[model samples]
Target: MSTGQATLPLLNTTLENCRMVIIGVDPHKDVLVAVAVDGNGRQLALRDAPARPRGYKTLLAWTAQFEQRLWAVEDVRHVAGGFVRCLLAAGESVVWVPTQMSSDYRKKVRASGKSDPIDALACARAALAEDLPAAVPDTEARNVKMLLDHREDLVGEMVRMCSRLRWHLHDIDPDFAATIPKHKLHRPKWNKSVQEFLARQAGSVAVAICVELIGRIQELAQRAAQLEREIAALVVIHVPQLLALEGCGPLSAARILAETGDVRRFTSAAAYAMHTGTAPIPASSGNTHRVRLNRGGNRRLNAAIHRIAITQKRMHEPARTYLDNRRAKGNSNTEAIRALKRHLARRVYALLKNGPDHAQADTTVQAA
Candidate 1:
């Protein structure tokens, strides 16, 4: 592929001395657009390639011209995962550029219109301006994430099937539908009862459909249970110390591990809290200094932390006492819970950072 030269010339002496190049990528299903920029964010060259193995090799060869180069790929993992893997495998330094940052940068550039090139340029500029995290190879965290996501999908499908079966049962036999417990359709005892009831029904279209739905739900439930067992085993191996925490269960531990991949990447606990969205945002105006709830960061990670906080408030004595102290200090229930979540984030960060040592120590302590 031919490379296009940009009109903007690199003039900054300091930036030129750095001799670093950033190549930003706008990835798509079929093709990828890349823009190469100097340390000063001055566009040097641009090219497009097919999103395939051959194209990846071609891009690698093309990028070889820049000795000190870093790839700034937009954090659209679904589209860029393969390319990122390829780059990492080739020992290339890469960083993920958040889509929001790239979009905001593009908006400020006064570009006439939007295109792959413009987006790629924005990614390059954003990378130059921000200290983004370096992308690393997928580890057990990816495996756990995949398993957890699959289980969730199966559970969702099972719920839908249960709803359809409930309606069918209601239409055929309201009395039986009334007897069936709500929200327990996945339970083996309840599922067995439903199957037995379906068998006694006279052969009909609705009966056949109900039978099919029940079978699908059972299958989904079984598969989801298998995935859960696998995920729990992984969590036990990876972060057993997380499970030792009062409110965190196997699934919660798995989620924490999956979302906060390589927690050591974070410089400190505060950084980890900021990533989890537990860190409050500053919203002060001069003398009226105040902080607001942070609604950014990884919402899924935030949700996992919230789940732990809620469970702790309900049953964990230490957590309950902590909340009481916060309330005694004039914090509202919501504010107390928010503070508790931030505290959990720091604990979780510590557990992840010292995973191996903490896991061994926890195991030994438990055995003793």
Candidate 2:
């Protein structure tokens, strides 16, 4: 799952009043090994099923023996999309188990060995030991997230292809790089003469490479643009308020909403910031007391926040004043950026939670 780290707290508060059956699954490309356990942690059944619609149906029937069954899935969004989607559509209660937690549980159970069945059992035990949050896979958010990721990949391919063309042009004709505008070089409209010249270099490998890379880049660019339009349309409908923020564009708004399915799940702005990796971590000792930038949490969401902070620092008057004040107080550039990101995180949280009417920023800077 593309989520912030899911930690099993030390308190170990589990479902006590109601008895619930946990069906833990270790999914793979072709098969899924699953184990069902009682609320008290006793294994009920273990089964190996094919990873298909028919197998999913059979698995449901098998688990039906239990009156109330909750599916505990590992990395539901990424590694087990097919099954997770099917389960969510079927309206089954699902809980996500992080890979680290599952592995740690497995080591405690069987210190010397590892296998699908063992992992499945460990997942069930972990679920039984903690109050895991339920997973709600929203159809709209999932579609938008996939499109955003696909567009990013397409953009990366375009950059690689352009870099290859630039390097080849530099090596073949050093003067070509200086004369041709970098931005114009990737277009089909590049002077017809240059194309003819590259085509004439038949004996050289660079000629073939350049021609192939250009074709791929053009195709990728077209697809990326199409995905961007789709993502923007979805964001406008689902999260128009986010777009109203000073620096959040359609893509940025979509990413934040997609990563965080429901704003209500976070109890407060601090929780939201921590989930986004913008919250500072304590780095203090006997002689000094201070906070440092968190290096963990949702990296993609962190990147979106960084982009917004950079945009606001460029043009937003309030953001500039805040940065200037922080700098004047002796904060370094990196620390100032972190503080700004934290502010944006809290701002986004309030906006998402309070609706569009609360879109305006306070313009009151916080202490550095």
Candidate 3:
């Protein structure tokens, strides 16, 4: 992995059937830099392309000069999205390399200072080392995630609007502020001041603003409700088994499916767990052996798993019984919850792949 040490004999041997050239892309808002490398990670061709349709075509034409090519894209959701999608649409093979992977190997791959081209080269080198999962676009899952995001945004807007209304109400009338509905953000019942101001045509703008804000807040609430109904319907059609699970509801199911797109990308349940940030890490030395909380994987996935674990602990008898059994075995509350989340992660992985799974919480128990 030295600066010029091309020829990854180990990876190259296994990747003999791979394309002749691996295109490494470092995408940016304004422009992108791509490096074409051989299986041995030797630099073949490098170019800077604009971040536009023409740039994409230009980059493709340049890469076409090479015999066979594969794309190694940085796993940036929005930034690299255009480039990756374009490649995929053209019926080309695309490999998603975590953005951090380039940073991880930047020190050893670059010659002097770091630039777009250098980072691109580093990405190419990293690509030769690991055969990353291909990027497969799933439209249904993507829509569910978008709806969830919009719903979250609407909820946040409602909160801010309510806070704003409360701030004004608190100054004008404390009692009125207290009466504002928490859910609907309704106007106060005893709003004589607003009425008086508007009736006298004095400072009616304030009334108009509050009215407008209230109207918007109410509209957002309605929209959010509609989105929930839609989200639930989509989840039911796409993944009903998750809803059948005692813990996962519509929002929970959407988040899980959206975040963990195409579980086949993950080789096994362990890999999926690792992605969820729940996989155990080694903390052992000498005769003692132990595992620690993995702070690595996707925290959002980990959080979704945490919510499921908590819900199951409360209502699901099997989940609660498993928790009690673990607690009885000298496991602390945190440890037991961690074990439960890992189990749920695997169950989720399985359920997402197909539907109506028979997997249960008890099936995931592992030895301490």
Candidate 4:
């Protein structure tokens, strides 16, 4: 392929600099494995540096050594936040490649491919070869991402504990949840108030078991609520506009911001949709095909967009009306929601991509 043909303008300056370094990171307990490689994808050095203080220092030193114009690292979603922060703090330009992409490359090239060193080398090669798109580095958004990641971790823990608690309660008392309505399982008030009744049961074994299970579940639920409140507070502090959307609550808004990073990186709404996996695939092959969903992009982003679509179907006028119209025209529920999601993603992309007159444009569209 020609160098300038498929190349985006974003690659111009970096390619000119040519002294690129790709750092493959395997973040362990106290240390992270960092393999630094030159632009030609040759390994330069390896380090077992501290995850927090020492790792960052090593990274800074390495950055100074290369004087590299561009840096690339594997994108590990929530896990790579700290590493990315360290790189950004040093004012280094960073790009992100998904682990799967790098792993597949390694497997294809090298027959034996299951070590940290090899993986690190693969990461370097991926960056040098343009195997993945360069990510928009956003330090401010990283702070927001930290909060979302913390909240997600707490929520996941709470969910697991809740499930275990339910099982323990069921084993002790078969009809424990029978007193409350089935749909109220997710409600904290129901869990809290009903626990008193369980605790007051005549049998001691049932009472003891119920007390233990309820106590654990209650604690988990409380923790989950605290995380929720913290997330809301952070959104209010940093990402206020995201919460302004009709169906976007604090959590969802934070998630969208965290996932998309710098929205301006997307050249157009279509680009944004394609990155988020909301864009329909081009399926024409000499007039032999229809469009289908592209599975090439971020799954989490797609899920987030799907959630936004579902939320808007109930709360936002345009979304709801559009879905209704689609369904009335004989589209299935899934199809209608997908159509709504594509439109919603475009709207979100527009709001983020456009400058100064976003509100006015949104209002004009609303009126029309």
The worst-scoring run of ten residues by lDDT in candidate 4 lies at 359-368
Q: 2 or 3, which is superior by lDDT? A: 2
Clashing pairs in 4: none
Q: Pick the candidate with the highest lDDT.
A: 1
For 148-174, candidate 4 gives per-residue lDDT tens digits of: 677677667766755665665666556
Model 1 TM-score relative to the real fold: 0.84
| lDDT string, candidate 2, 1-368, tens digits | 33785422222227563467889999887888899988787888899899888889888888878887788877645658889878878878777666666777788774369999888888888878755545665657787888888889888878777777878878888886567677655566664445776876756787777777677777887788888998999887777788878888998998998877666656568867866889898888996756787865567889999999999889887888889888897777787889999998988888787765654545344554
Q: How accurate is candidate 4 locally (lDDT)?
A: 0.65
Error of 4 at 196 (Å): 4.3
Q: Which residue segments of model 3 deviate by more than 4 Å?
A: 1-21, 37-45, 65-69, 99-115, 118-131, 175-208, 328-331, 356-368
Q: Model 3, residue 80: displacement in angstroms?
A: 2.6
Which regions of candidate 2 are displaced past 4 Å? 1-23, 35-47, 62-69, 76-79, 98-133, 178-205, 265-271, 292-295, 320-336, 356-368
Q: Return whichever of 1 and 3 wins on TM-score.
A: 1
For residues 218-284, could you state the per-residue lDDT of candidate 1 as single tens digits? 8999999999999999988888888878778989988888888877556678867877889977777
lDDT digits (tens) for residues 166-222 of candidate 3: 676566557756755564453343234344433554455555677676667767877
Candidate 3, lDDT over the whole model: 0.75
- Candidate 3: 10-residue stretch with minimal lDDT: 5-14
